[model samples]
Target: MNSNNDVIRKLHELTEADMSEAEFLQSVENNMIPMQQFFTYYRCAIMEIETKFRVLNEQFSLNGESNPIEFIQSRIKSYGSIFRKIMTNHIPRNVEAIERDINDIAGIRVVCSFVQDIYRLADCFLRQDDITLIEKKDYINNPKPNGYRSLHLIVAVPIFLENEKRLVKAEVQLRTIAMDFWASLEHKLRYKKDLPPYQLNLLADDLKKCADQSAEWDRRMQDIKNILESN
Candidate 1:
């Protein structure tokens, strides 16, 4: 069996030399253990972040406050997707480089009940001493060109191992329930390759209109909640 460093070095060589996909797969097959271990660290980091949000939700319940979080979803990027990213972006071909450049190896999506809850949960998560904020993109305030909206955060959290503690990066996306619903449908429709160009354009326009309406709904719901709280 190759040592971890040896496996990393071999993989780096294979990627850097632009080996055939079959050759790369053979190398990966021979050295699956180390690669799997690398991704496992990211999984641990996701668990740590998820636990923090779960605890916060539980605290709100205990205090008779409305739970802000509706649901939490987490995923680790597949190896094939990671490889495509490395090749597409001309990233450095090494384990260290991949870890450094890929911010979303592990991801957590937190769906909140209201727009306000998105920022509230983000603030609470970032305020913790153990979590380090690496980057933040407020797409909710400034929607993307396609009218997508979400609060994206790239954070580093320490994951404890039996022998060492590793700080891994994971992306946290906070969005309102309506926003999530809109995004889910948009993603599904946008990926259909069979759609004609004209139809695609029309679909895109409709999606943008829907996004605007959903955002307005979120605002009105939040206002009603504020009124009730004031009573």
Candidate 2:
């Protein structure tokens, strides 16, 4: 694998220096194997993290506590998306560079029942010794200008291969059910290329209002849950 990457690095250097289309294609073909290997490692890391969440949910059930996590979704970035990012970011065309820079190449979305549940689950997950927190963005508290609300965490987990233990990074997005619903709709509508600028602005404003309402709903639901627990 090392020899293959070394060769690929040389090819990448040539490509940077304006290699022909045939040479570029050859470099891509050579990169395919190592790229797939890196993706496999990322998938393994996702499995490890998902299993941890599942265990946490089960423990909550066993202790007569409602499960915090509603559902989990995991995915690897598609080749087209990866290539677009590499070109747009001017990143080195190598597996190592991609693995180091593309933190969201492997992603896991965890939707919870309430706002508090999101934080609770995150704290519990991060407390584990093996899970390394690389970066955190608290969008729930400090939402985006478009009113997006979610806790984004870039975490590293060790995936044991046949002869090596490699640490892989994955982005974990935690949000409440309401927030997720609003985000899903917003995402679907945001990409309507047919919409004119004025219409798009109007749609954005509506989505922002909806996001605020969703956040309020989450707060109310959390308060009710707290009241019930206190009783």
Candidate 3:
């Protein structure tokens, strides 16, 4: 029985037409157990990655000079058509060893002081031999036509437990405080259309300029904090 009510209903109907009552019940139990495990394992993996990022971020903060970071990892709900495709088609095929192999299983966002630091910290994070670099996009250096800027990387890592070793992939984002603020605001009001394209383009250009200015301010702020700490 799939945890999903709809799937269980459909499975019951399908089995009613073909299998004996006891056999159908046994099949449901067997199949649902592994399916449930697939989700549970991925959730555990995401939590582990989040905890690692938290430890790293706290270590960086101890210097009182590094910008903050946040991490989030979550399971995509099994209600949408996307999940339908994933479960019925993808999972059935066992095309990938894990369901997280398809979705955004793990995510981390690092907020740095300056544009330069974004790349610096990203390089530092990727330097871990345990992490296998899969893909990268330096959006900060090469902003999208929409003037969005950030660094994106996908990394594959091998997680070992007492019982087994599993390969997990995580997406990491790096951006400055200004860039993150702008992105957050944009996301909040994404449905607005009153702003003309030309105005939006001009706004993006202005925000890019602001991002640069904020980077300078961040450096100055860090310097001021350091000087005070020394005193």
What is the C-alpha lDDT profile of model 2 across 1-231, one tens digit per residue?
A: 578645554434442355443443343533554544767888998999999999999999999998888999998776655665676577887666777888998899999998888888999999999999999999999999999999999999999888988999999999888988998888777656566789989988988998998888888888999999999
For residue 160, give model 1's deviation from the true position in Å. Answer: 0.7
Task: Please report, in order, the local distance difference test score of every candidate based on alpha carbons.
Answer: 0.86, 0.83, 0.60
Model 3 misplaced regions, further than 4 Å: 1-36, 61-103, 192-231
Residue ranges of candidate 2 with Cα displaced over 4 Å: 1-33
What TM-score against the true fold does each predicted structure earn? 0.86, 0.86, 0.58
Clashes of 1: 0
Highest-lDDT candidate: 1
Candidate 2, overall lDDT?
0.83
Better of 2 and 3 by lDDT: 2
